[model samples]
Each structure stands twice: as C-alpha cells, then as structure tokens.
Target: RFMDSAKRLPNKPMVVFEGQEWTFAQMHEWSNHLAHFWIAQGIGHGDIVCQMLENSPDFIANWIALMKIGATAAFINFRLPPKALAHCLRIATARTLVFHPAFAATVDAVRADLGAATDTAPACPPWATLVDGAVWRVHPATPPPPSRTAAVDFADPAMLIYTSGTTGLPKAAIVSHMRMTLAAVGFPGMYGVSESDIIHCTLPLYHASAALIGFAQACFLGSTVVLSRRFSVSRFWAEVRESRATVVQYIGELCRYLLQASASAAAAATTDHRVRIAIGSGLRPDIWEAFKRQCGIPEIGEFYASTEGTAYLFHWHRAGAPGAGAVGYFGPLARVMNGIKVLRVDPDTHEMVVDSQTGYGQVAAPGEPGEMISRITNEPHKRFNGYFGDASASEKKVLANVFSDGDRWFRTGDLISVSADGYYYFHDRLGDTFRWKGENVSTTEVQEAFEGMPGLVEANVYGVALPGTDGRAGCAALQWAPGHPPPDADARRQLAATLRQRLPPYAVPVFLRYVPQLEHTATLKQTKVALRHQGADPRVCADPLFVYDAGARTYVPLSAERYVAL
Candidate 1:
C-alpha cells in the first residue's frame, strides 16, 4: 500500500508533525531505508519486533518498515512501568526491541527483569536497539533487495495490539494484514473521507485507533495525517488549525476534556478550526450535540469497535436530528448480515439467560439491555485470531453452542440496547453495571447524568463496597469545571436535587468525592478498580468526601464522626 500510494501520489503529503512534513515518496523511502537497516541486523520475515516509541514520524516509518519485511510489529505502550513493560516484552517473544532514546531509563530499569545482559544485546542475536527517534533520521533512501522468501499473505499477522488491561494483564491481540487493510480502506469510504482530507490524529500510535485506523486510512487514501506526540486539550484547536486538518480523531474522554477546557479558555483558542468531521468512539449523548455546536464541527462519526471484536458499529451523525447517543443505526440488511445478537443475561452473575428447552441464550427484548455477541465464522474477515500466547484467555471470550448446537459466538462483554427504530445504544460494560438496592445500575448512565449538572466537569461513577450492605453502593468521583469553585453547600444541594430528578433513587450516587481530575487508563477510559477498592473511606482518600443524607436530601461532608457512625 505504501509503495502503491507513493507511486500514484509522490508529491502528496502523507504526514505532518510539528511543522515537519513527509510526502508519500519521502515516507516510503524512509521506511525502505529502515527496512534495509532491520534486515542488515538479521531481522527477517515472520520475526517479531517490539517497538516502544511515542507518536512520531519514526514510529510510522518503523511500522511501515516492519510491515514491508513481513515482520510483526509489537507496539508497546511507552508509559508502562517496569514490571508491566517487562511482562509485555516477554510475552511478545520479539527477537528485536527498538525503542526511543527518551525511554532509555525505563528500559534500563527493566533490563535486569528482561533477562538481558545489556540494553543493546539482550542475550540474543537480534537485540534491543535504542534510537533517538527525533535526531536519528539517517537511513538508506533506496529499497532493499527483494526477499526470495514467500510473498506476504493477507492472513499473516502484521501487528500485535495489546488490550488496555483494565481487568488484568494486557493481552496482545493478533491483528492480521487483512484486518488492518480493511480498517484502512473500509473506514475512510464508510466515513466519507477522501484524498483531499487531512486527518488530525492525537491518539497514541501504539493504539489501534491511530495506527490501523488513522495511519492506515491515510496510506490507503493517499491523504495526510497531522500527528501529535500526545493529546493536549489546550493545544488541540491550535494544532488542528495550523495543520489545516479537515477531520480529527478522538475518544470520548478527549472530547470531554476539550469541552471542559473550552468552557474556561479564551474563545479564539477553539473557535475556528477547519475541522468538518470528528470521528471515534465513546462520545456520550450529554456531550454529543454540545461538542458539535461548540466546536463548529457538524459531522460526528461515532463508532463502536474493540481491538479483538469481529463486528463493528458506525454511527454517522451527518444529518443529525437529535440522535445524540446512539452508537449506530442498522438497516434491516445490515442487521441480518452482521449477525449481531443481544442476549439476555443475569446482571449479577453475568451468565447468559439460557432457555430451558433449547439450552441456548435468549435474545433480549427491544429496549432491554443485554450482552452483545457476534457470530464467529471460518471466513478470514469474520475470524477471531485470539490473544497471543494465551489460549485460555481467548477461549474465555468465545461462547460455544450459544444459540444452537455447534454454533460459536464472540462475547463482547458489553451491554447494549436496540430501539424499535433500529438504533443501537451502549448501556455499559458488563463489569461496570452493579446491583444497588436489588436493581442493576449502569455507571455510564449515572455518570452522564452527573455530567449534565451545572459546575460539574467530569464524573467517574463506580460501585463501592459498604459494610452491612447487600451489594456495592454507587459512588461518584467528580471534577469541577475549570474556573468554577468546588461544589459549595448550595451547589452540592442543587446537584443532589438534579440527580434525584434525573436518575432513579437507587441509581443516584450515594457518595460523592470532589477530585481535581480522574485517573484514566492508557486509552483515556476512566479507571475505577482502585477507587472501588478504597470505597468511601475518608482515611484512604484525601479528596473532600461527601455522603448523601437521605433525610436531609443533600450531600454533606463525611466527617470522621459521621464516617464512624455509618
């Protein structure tokens, strides 16, 4: 694809990064040079090469080089700590580890654990190489000798993208050449992106969103991608305007942060970006229309997909008529062709609601939330490659004999509801829904409600354990809007009242904690595991903790005396 695009549009800019630009020809030549360098170092076809670098031109070039040589690129999260970093490296079983020099200290910290004598030669032939990506741009400009080996196949694994590891250790998902190609070619056309489009990509390159979707789309369309080292809400509009990007990629949290920042920052900072379309997932209904209005971006291409999942949902909000939060709208043909089934399941146990007669999971009724399961098939496009080196973990996501004998389905582990109009709405992750007062509560719904309250910037809702309680109670870690005072007595009372009106009694958060900002995973998803473990204990949390007073109908600080009494 790189060579083909370069041949067709040699002068067209392929990547723009911090004022530096790389045309299709330039990018292809650089990648060829890097491929030659890797081959000279004994890296060959079918070899695994680990990469730990920030979003940069070198990262793109390295990925292309690896793909050209038929080597699987294991893109590692650069922010990982020593133990996790070591684990990922070991699990990938990569013959070579090429990382940015900025991460040299982190690499050295884990060197002993990596079972390597030195950083350069990790007791292996093709060893760890630390390259200063920003400074080291030297590589042969000509293509390397063509391989006498077998041609690369679409079924070959091209990359290993690791899961976010919210529940446990991150599992690497094998992304095949076909999958990458489909995302690159399919999404651009699906989202109405063209060669004239310049995509602003601030998401991490290590993520599938940036690499497979953003970069690959640009490659396939012979378009341009304006790259950022990382996402910065304050710098977002400036970069977009400077790069003259027509479309921007985002995650839900990024949009929330941008909206929150715009509320306080100067209007000129965000007013006039050339962006016409914003694409990605996790934009909730509360912020959807607001984001489009505030940012002046009319089109929102919200999609629902996971690194390992087979099925995908694309919500094109081009002719938007208040469909703020639906992930996607499926026509009758798509409904049957995709084979996406919503099966009823026990909220508490998370087990499928099996029919006694058929011994299969029952399809959920319309408007009722259920776990989404996609049919698995032998076709390459519908195949699940499973997690790398963990067959049991992979098997856990597959449901055998789900609807009929010998039938298999991939468990999405997400709860969603379909309306009579054929619109699909995401409820929450299966694990994020908890029982409170004998009723299931979706943290996403509660969080969205809280975000609607005045002066609230963000809300991270989770269920926390309470002594003598039957199940976990709802707790919210809240962030105040910039320049706004933390929720005062009156504000807290108003917030409580607003939530009471918007949510059911059981769903209303029982406890509230004012935080400066919420912790997030690498992908910017809210992290709840740590907070859930700490519960409402004031000793563990320094934030101003408050509990809802049922009698008073307001939130009051959880003083030590009240804490002990509870």
Candidate 2:
C-alpha cells in the first residue's frame, strides 16, 4: 500500500513533524535503506525486532523498514520503568533492540537484566546489544534486494502491541497482517475520509490508535499525516493550524484538557482551525456535545475497542441530538451480524447469572447494564489472536458455552446497556462498579453528576474500604482548574446538595479529596488503583481531604482524629 501511494504521489507530504516534512518518495527511500542495512546485519525474514522510541520520523521509518523485510516489530512502551522495560524485551525474545539516543540511560539501567548475545538460543536474546536508530538514516537510500524466500501470509504476525497493563505486567498482543489491513480499511470507511484529508496524530506511536488507525489509514489513502513528538495542550492549535490538519485523533482526557484550557490565551485558536472531525474513544457523554460546540469541530467519531479484543463499536456523533451519549448505534443488519450479546452478572463478583434450565448465562433485559460479549468463530473478521507469548493469559478472556453447547464468546470485561432502539451505551468496567448498601453504584454515573460544577475541573471516582462497613464506601478525587480556589465549606455544601439531587442516597460520595492533578496512564486515562489503596488516610495523603457529615449535610476536613473516629 505504501509503495503504491509513493509511486502515485511522490511529491505529496507523507509525514510532517515540527518544521520538517518528508514526502512519500523520501520516506519510502529511507525505509528501503534501513531495510537493507538490517538485512546486512543478519536480521533475516520473520525475525523479531524490538523497538523503543518516542513518536518521531525515525519511529515511522523503522516500522516501515521492518514491514519491508517481513519482520515482526515488537513495539515497546517507552514510558515504562527499567524493570518493565527489561521484561518487554525478554518476552519478545527479539534478536536486536533499536532505540533513540534519548533513552540511552533507560537502556543502560536495564542492561544487567538483559542476557548476553550467544550463538546458542537461550530464554532471551542479547537485547543488551543496542543499535542506534540515527545510524540507519545515514545508510544509502536504495531499494532492498529482492528476497528469494516465500512471501509472508496474510494471517502471519505483523506486529506485537503491548497492553496498557492496568492490573499487572503488560502482555504483548499479536496483530496479524490481515488484522492490520482491516483496521486501515475499516477506520476510513467508517469515518468517510479520503486522501484529500490531512490527519493529525499526537498519540504515542506504540499505541494501536496512532500506528494502525492513524498511519495505516494514511498509507492506504495516501493522506498526509502530521506527527507530534508528544501531546502539548498549549501548542496543539498551533500545530494543527500550521499543518492544516482536517482530522485529529484523540483520547477522552485530551479532549477534556483542551476544553479546560479553552479559556487561556494559548488556546486562542480553539474555535478557529481547519479541523472538521475528531476521532477516538473515551469521550464522556457529559462533555461530548460541549467539546464539539466549544471547539467548533463538526463531527466526533467515538469508538469502543481494545488492543487484543475482536469486538468493535463505533458512534458517528454529528448535529448532536444527545442520544443518551451512546458509544455505538446498530441498525437492524448490524445488530444481527455483529453477534453482540449482553449477559447479566454480579457487579461485585463478576459472575454470570445462569439460567436454571439451560445452565447458560442469562441475557440482559432491554436497557439493563451487563457485560458485553462477542461470539468467536473461524471467520477471518471474527478471529481473536490472543496474547503473543502466554496462552494461559489469553484463555482467561474466553468464555465457553456462553449461550449454547460448544459455543464460545470473547469476554469484553465492560458493562454496557442497549436501548430498545439498538443504541449501545457504556456503563462502566466490570470491576469498576462496586456494591454499596446492597445496591450497585456506578462510578461513571456518580462522576457525571459533578459535571458543570463551578471551580471543579475533573473528578476521579472510586470505592474505598471502611471499617465496620459491609462494602466499599464511595470516594471522589477532585482536581480544580488552574487558578480556581480549592473547595471550601460552602463549596462542599453545594457539592453535597447537588450530588444528592442528581444521585441516589446510597450512590452519593462519602468522601472527597482535592488534588493538583490526577494521575494518568500513557493514554491519559485516570488510574485509581493507588488512590483506592490510600483511601482517606490523612497521614498517607497530604492533599486536602474531607469527609461528609450525614447529619450536617456537608463535608468537613478529615484529620487523623476524624479518620480514627470513623
């Protein structure tokens, strides 16, 4: 696809980074040079090569070179610590590790953990032997020698993308050539974008969103892609304006941060840009319409998917009528063809509700929130490749005999509800919903009530353990916008009153803590594992903490004495 695009539009810009630009022909030639250089270094066909670099031109060029040589590129997350970095290379068993000079310290820190290079194959290859990516750019720009080996099959592994590892060590997910090709075709067809469009990508290159959804589509359509080394809220509009990007990729938090920064001088171009559409996942319903209206973007393509899962859901939000903030809308044909099934389950234990007669999981009623599952089959489009090196870890996501004998389904680990009209709404993750007072409390729904609150920028809701309590108690970590005053007694009272009006009594947050900013993963999703463990301990947390007084109907400072009394 890239070769064809380069031949048809040699002068067209393929990648724009900072002030530098590379045309299709230029990048193609550079990739060929790198491919030949690697082949000369004994990196033959079907070899596994580990890559750790930030979002840059070299990253794109290196990925293309790997594809040309029919090698599987193991994309390592650069943000990981030294321990996790070593684990990635060990799991991949790559013959060579190529990285940017900026990460030389990180590589040095993990050198002792990586085994030495040896002729005899061991548990792990010699990842300690590093190759500088800068050296490949100076290689002669020419086409690589034609291979006498057989061509790579469609189902063969093309890349290994690591999961976010929210719970434990990140596992590499195998992405086949067919899957990558489908992603390139599916995103553009769904968004109705063409080669005339210029796409802007600021997400990490190792992520599937930027690599497959952003660059792959550009390669297929011969579209220009503006790449950013990293996402900067202050320089976002300038970059978009300079590149004249028509479409931008984002996660929900990036959109929220942009909206919050709209009032600052840096965001003067918030409503004035060439961008016509914004695409990605995790856009909250409360801010969906507001982001579009405030940013002057006409369309939002919010999708629901995962790195390893086969199921996908899409919502093309435009001219917003506020349709329950659904993640996807399925017509009659899609409803039947997609094979999406929602099954009732215990919110706390995550156990399926089985029918006595059939001994199969019961289907969720209309408008009932439950785990979404997709049927597994041998069809090319419905296949699940699972994790790369661990079969047991991959088997954990498969549920057998879900609805009938010998039937298998892929567990999504997400709670979703489908309206009678076929619109699908995301509720929360399976473990994110906690039981309070014998009733299920949705952190997402509770957090949504905090929207539009004066001085509050964002809220991260979670459940915390309390002594003498039957289950976890509701807690919210709040972050105020820049220059906004922290929550005072009056503000706490107002918050309590509003939450009581918007949520049930049991669902109201029992505690609140103010922070400068919330901790997030590389993709900008808020993480609550550490916050949950800390709970309301004033000794452990220096941030301003407050606890609700049920009788007073307001919140007061949570001192160590107050915590002990509770």
Candidate 3:
C-alpha cells in the first residue's frame, strides 16, 4: 500500500520536520537503502527489532525499512527508566536494539543487562548496532530483493507499541499489518480528511495515536505531515502556521498546556494558523470551548480508544452541537451493528454486576454509567490482536459468558454513559491506571517502585484531580515503619531524586502525603477512597502534604498559600 502510494505521487511531500522535507519518492529511496543495509546485517522476516528514538523523519523511514524486510519494530518509550527499558526489550524478545545518538546514554545504561539472553528470550544479536548518520551515509541507495517481504502476511505483527493498559508495567501491544491497514483507511474516511489535508503531529511517534493514526493515515491518504521533535507550547502554533497544516493532531494534555501558556506571548501566536480541525483524544469538557475559541481553531475531533483494545468511538464537534465535549456518539444503527454493550459494574471494586445464578452481567440502560464492552469475535475489523507475548494478560481483558453462556466480551476498563441522544460521555478509568500528561500512569506500578524505599512501610498511590489540568495528578500516601521517622527535608529531596531515576517522569508522584495509617476494605485490601477524596488539598486533609517542586528539585510543604498558587 505504501509503495504504491509513493509511486503514484512520487514528488508529493510526505513529511516535514525541522525545516527539512522528504517527498514520497525520497522517503521511499532512503527506506530502500536502509532495508538493504539491515538485510545485509542479517535482519530477516519475523525478527523482533527494538527502536528508541525521538520524532524525526528518519524514525518513520526506519520503521518503513523494517516493514520492507517483514520485521517487527518494537518502539520503546523514551521516557522510561533503564529498568523499564530493559523489561520492554525482554518482553519483545528483541534481537536488535537500534537507537539515535540522542538516546546513546540511555542504551548504555541498560547495555550490561541486555548482554545475556534469559530463560524466556534470546540475546541481542552481535551485529545489532547503533543507527548513526554514518550508517545511512555508507549504505548504498538500493532496494533489497522483492522476496524479502513477499511472504509477509496481513496478520503478521507489524509493530510492538507499548501501552500502560490498566496494569503495572508497560505491555507491548501487537499491531498487525491488518490493524494498520484498517486504521489507515478507516480514520481518514471517518474524518473526511483528504490528500490536501496537512496533519501536524506533535505527539511521540512511538505512540499509536501518532504512528498508526497520524502518519499511517496521512501516508494512506497521500497527505503531508509536519512532525516535531517534541511538543513546544510557544513554537506549536508557529510550526502549524509555517507548515500550513489544515489538521493538527493532539492529546488532551497538549491542549490544556496550550491553553495554560496562552496567558503569555503564545496567546497572540494562536490565531491565524491554518489549522481548521483539532483531532485527538482526552479533550475535557471544562476547557473544550475555551481551547477552540482562544486558539481560533474551528473544530474539535475527540476520539475514545485504547492501544490494545478494538473498541473505538469518534466525535466531530461543531458549534452548538450536542457532542461538543462527549467522547463519541453511538448512532442507533451503528450501536446495534457493532454489538457493544454497557454493563453495570461496581464502581469501587470495578467488577461487573452479574447474576448470581446465571453468572451473566447486567446491562446498563441508556444514561446510566457502566463499563463499555465489545463482543470478542474473529472478524477482521473487530478482532482483538492482544499483547505480543503474554496470552494470560490478554485473556484477563476478555470476560467469559458476559451476557449468555460461553459468550466473551472485551473489557474496555472505562466507565462511560450514553445519553438518549446517543452521545457517549467518559466517566472514569475502571482500574489502577489514570491519565497524566497524556500517558497512562499505573498506580500499581508506582506503588511497586516505592516498595523498597528506606522508611516507607505502606504506600497507596492514586490520581488526584487538580484545577486547570485535563487529567489527574499522581499522589502517593506514605506510612512510615514504626521505628522510621517521617521524611525530612533532605530525605524528601533524595526520595524525589530516587523516584525520578526509577520511574518515568510522568509516573512519578507529583504529591506526597504522610499519614499515620491507611484505610482498608473489609477484604483487608488497602482502599484509596478517602485519600483520593481528600486529594492534595492542605485545607481538607489532616495529614501533612507536600507537593513536588520540579524547579526546586525537591518536595515542599503544600500550605494553603502554596496550594492556591498551584
């Protein structure tokens, strides 16, 4: 599909990045060269190759090259610590590790651990090397033999995109060529986006939203994409303007950041951009109008989806429309055809409300909040590709006998409601994960990271709602050991530093609460209800609260004044 598109529009601009543009023909030629180089290095069909790189034209080209040889590229999250990075590589059973110069230190930090193969996976091949400018410079600009990719099947794994899917560590979701092809054709047709539309993407290319949804769709539509190294509040509108992007892709947090930064010179820069439609997920209702009006963008296209799940919903917002802030709308016909259900679930335990005798879930009525689930089927469109190497993990998302005997449904792990008018509203995440900085922060993962901390005996992590933020902020309630004292100024600073080194930046707790004891459920499990309700508010919580001061590199007591300032 990509080769045919490139051949048909050889001179069309496919990607624009850092003032450099690559046409379809140029990108194809470069990818061909990369394919030949990797083939020579012994990379073959079905080989798992890992990637750690920032958003760049070469990043996309490298992925294309891997596809040309029928190899699966596992895109590692660059924000992860060395431990998490190693875990991802091991899970993917990657044979080669490829990274850009910017991530050389990160790769080196995990190099020793990756040297030997484990019981479950093989060692990295010795020929696996860094992809520097020198490699591309030395390789001949020629395509590999056609037989290299001829045996590739549509169901073959194309990419391994890691997602923190309501669980403790990141899981590599298997994105098949079939899934990619569907998304490439499905999204553009849904949005009515055409070849003339220029999509501006600031999200990380490692993320499915940017890779499968943004770049793949643009490639399929024969549209141009303006890529950025990272999202910049000040430079965002300028890039969109300069590139004349008709559609700008975003996650909810990016929109909030833009709105927050608009108080400065960025306010003036938001207007007059060529952006007509802003499309992405997590646009909060609180700031939807403000973002569209203040930024001078005419439309907001909000979608609700998961990296590994098959359930998808889209909403195209227009002024005075009923679907302004809703995640999506389920038309009657579409709903029936899709066979999706909203089943009642216990909000506290996140368990489905099922009949004791029949063991079937009770379906929620319209306007009632419930967990949205789709039937698990073998159909190409609705099939669940699941995690790459963990069948048990994948099976956990499938509920047995959902509505009837021997029936199964894919649990979305989201609480949602559909109004009488068919507008669907997002309620809450059903499990131990919450959205922070456009990424899923797993509470269980954060708690596990805090387990061996010197003085901490008990830790409860949860998301706290904050003013002026689209998603929740991470907060951890800590109870010290009997003999250990509470964290002092220096201890707090060192603890913050340790957390920053052990976890991803976004996963680190933004607020800390020192408590004498933690509440528990009747089942003896720790409960976060009280702590989450109190949040990080100093006025409400009896326990001492400290907020992370990123600029100061430590934690400071969150007094009423400090809380108000935040």
- Score residue 195 of candidate 1 by CA lDDT: 89
Candidate 1 local accuracy as lDDT? 0.86
lDDT (Cα, tens digit) per residue for candidate 1, span 178-230 = 89998998788888999899999999999899998899988888989999999
TM values, all candidates: 0.94, 0.94, 0.77
Every candidate's lDDT:
0.86, 0.85, 0.82
Question: What's the TM for model 2?
Answer: 0.94
lDDT of 3 by residue, 212-237 (tens): 88899877788999999988887889
1-566: candidate 2 lDDT, tens digit per residue: 88899999999999999889999999999888888788877886788999998998888888888888888899998889877788888989898888776776787788768863533222323443434445566666876655712577778788999988766678999988888998889988998888999999999989899999899887888999999999999888888988899999999889888887775544447877888889898888888887887887899888888877878898888784456368888887888789788889877789788899989999898899999998888776678899988999899999888888898888899999988888889999887888889999999999989987888888999999988878888999999978988867898899899999999999999889998988877787678888999998898889999998999999989999999898
TM-score of predicted structure 3: 0.77
Say which prediction, candidate 2 or candidate 3, comes out ahead on TM-score. 2
- Rank all candidate structures by their lDDT, best first, as comma-separated numbers: 1, 2, 3
Clashing pairs in 1: none
Q: How many residue pairs clash in each candidate?
A: 0, 0, 0
RMSD of each: 2.9, 3.5, 11.5
Candidate 3 runs further than 4 Å off: 116-130, 137-140, 165-167, 265-267, 356-358, 432-566
Error of 1 at 185 (Å): 1.1
